[model samples]
Target: MSEVAMKPEIRVLETADADTFWKLRLRGLKEDPEAFGASLADSVDATHEEICKRLACTDDSFALGAFNPEPCGMLGFYRRQGERVRHKGSIWGVYVAPEARGTGLARRLMVEAIERAKKMPGLEEVLLTVSTTQGPAMKLYESLGFKEYGHEVKALKQGDLYIDEKAMMLRLHD
Candidate 1:
């Protein structure tokens, strides 16, 4: 197949996409357990019903997926709930299938997420956490104008190793 043919098309995920979203998310957690707080093994016990509820919630949260005619990767973001923190949002659960990596799908997903975030009323900035081991991801975030604001020690643990994560932010001007 050609390069473009192999690349997945990016789109906003809908409520009816619970199973596909869950499967892609679990795959990401399995491939990079340290990249996120959730573990694939732990989520394996979660039912599609739970996922459907999450996806259907109409709030300051949203998910986007990339599909090769089938869901292959996904990203999610949510705004803080408290009135004091409502202006800020956090990005999480960013993952692409192993087969979809290095094809610019992740960047496309990020762009879509960022665009959606900017449209949110009263939003000030978007933040994300990335492990030090995720060098490529860090570079991608930086290229998109995200700056390192701080770091958390032992933010994640896998096996006996503790991984530190860098907190990055991108400010949106009103």
Candidate 2:
């Protein structure tokens, strides 16, 4: 196996990271709409305050950022906040800049996110949705022990094109 250079420094993002995180996230949504649900056009008007407010949430929900000096990629875990559903969390918004794709930054961020999720109180499984268009991401999740539970046809529609999404989950413990 070939070695990956550019040691990735991954950390859980706080409110202070909203600006950089927003920029990177907007780029991801704009560049690859099929991979994400949020569209740049819809979220562009959000004030910095709104952005910071969302990031300031220091609860079970968290956004993890990977920086190889600069912001390279991000992954997030959104905990289900119901009395009965709190045992599960959903992972979303996995993004790595095109320039950073081959460097294993995405994998590093994902592994760290999973590690954090396992440590989260009451969290037993982590779920994620990936469109069929995201083959690499799907394969990466599969390699990391996530199993597909179902597929949703026409899960997303952009203009006239419909996309199918696969729902996958990883059990943190037996």
Candidate 3:
């Protein structure tokens, strides 16, 4: 049997990584406009404070970065609060640089995010939404054990076009 190539190192983002994280995030948004709700054009005029606020949220949230001597991708998970919703967490803002796309960085990021979700205090499952056009992303998530639990019709409107989103979930057993 052939051997699988090992992936580059991945680690949780620390306070010092805020700028690097933001740069990679904006790059992802710019390159894949249809994959996310946020646009680089909109974020271009955003202040450093706005970007800091986003990168600084780590209380019940996790932001991971994959590196090959430099940051190449990022993925984040935010645990739901409120007594009723605390059992769930949402995976959001997943992205990999174009140069890193075919190297399995996305899968590595998802693996780290899922492991983090499984360790959350009361989390029963993790949820994420993907645009219907992102078949590759859908396949990656599904391969990692996420099920297509539901879909939101015309959930996003982009310049006269309506896009549907598929809601996916991965359950962690008690």
Candidate 4:
């Protein structure tokens, strides 16, 4: 079977997968700096132990990995912690490698994340931000039922480039 024809194994990444997750995350940050809120430099000093802590799955937070026998795509979801905001969650660090872009891997990861979010006890809505430069990603989120609620001008400044970001949200229930 052709590699592209095979379904990727998507699962919640755990502590042991931290190293793999970190490498892919760095690539994502570096390869598409404007698409993410964090830069490669901000993450380079993060230790393996810190990544393991982040990957430790909890009822309200976890990271998903799409593996074609190795991590290729990643997305993070975490519910708000404070009492007033606990009903909301945010999706972060969404990335799919160049090789995986057209294979529907990103959509699969998103569907899985939304499904998981729906199961959380107090999760009423999920939110994420996308740079205006990411039109394809914005379209994918829209197709998945996310609505743009706001726009931030110059949300991120990378060198001389200023990225505007759209904030989008998906409500799980009425």
Highest lDDT among the candidates is held by which one?
A: 4
Model 4 lDDT-worst window of ten: 47-56
What is the Cα root-mean-square deviation between model 3 and the actual structure? 2.9
Tens-digit per-residue lDDT, 52-128, candidate 2: 76555466888888887788898888888979999999888899999889777788888988888898888999999
Candidate 1: segments with Cα more than 4 A from true spot: 1-7, 57-59
Candidate 2 C-alpha error for residue 4, in Å: 8.3
Candidate number that wins on TM-score, 2 or 3? 2
lDDT of 4: 0.93
For model 4, residues 40-82, the per-residue Cα lDDT tens digits are: 9999889887888777699889999999887899999988999
**How high a TM-score does candidate 3 get?**
0.89
Worst 10 residues of 1 by lDDT: 50-59
Residue pair clashes in candidate 2: none
Task: Score residue 10 of candidate 1 by CA lDDT.
Answer: 78
What lDDT does each candidate get? 0.85, 0.87, 0.83, 0.93
Models ranked on lDDT: 4, 2, 1, 3
Which residue pairs come into collision in candidate 3? none
Off by over 4 Å in 3: 1-6, 57-59
- Best candidate, TM-score: 4
Ranking by TM-score: 4, 2, 1, 3
Candidate achieving higher lDDT, 3 or 4: 4
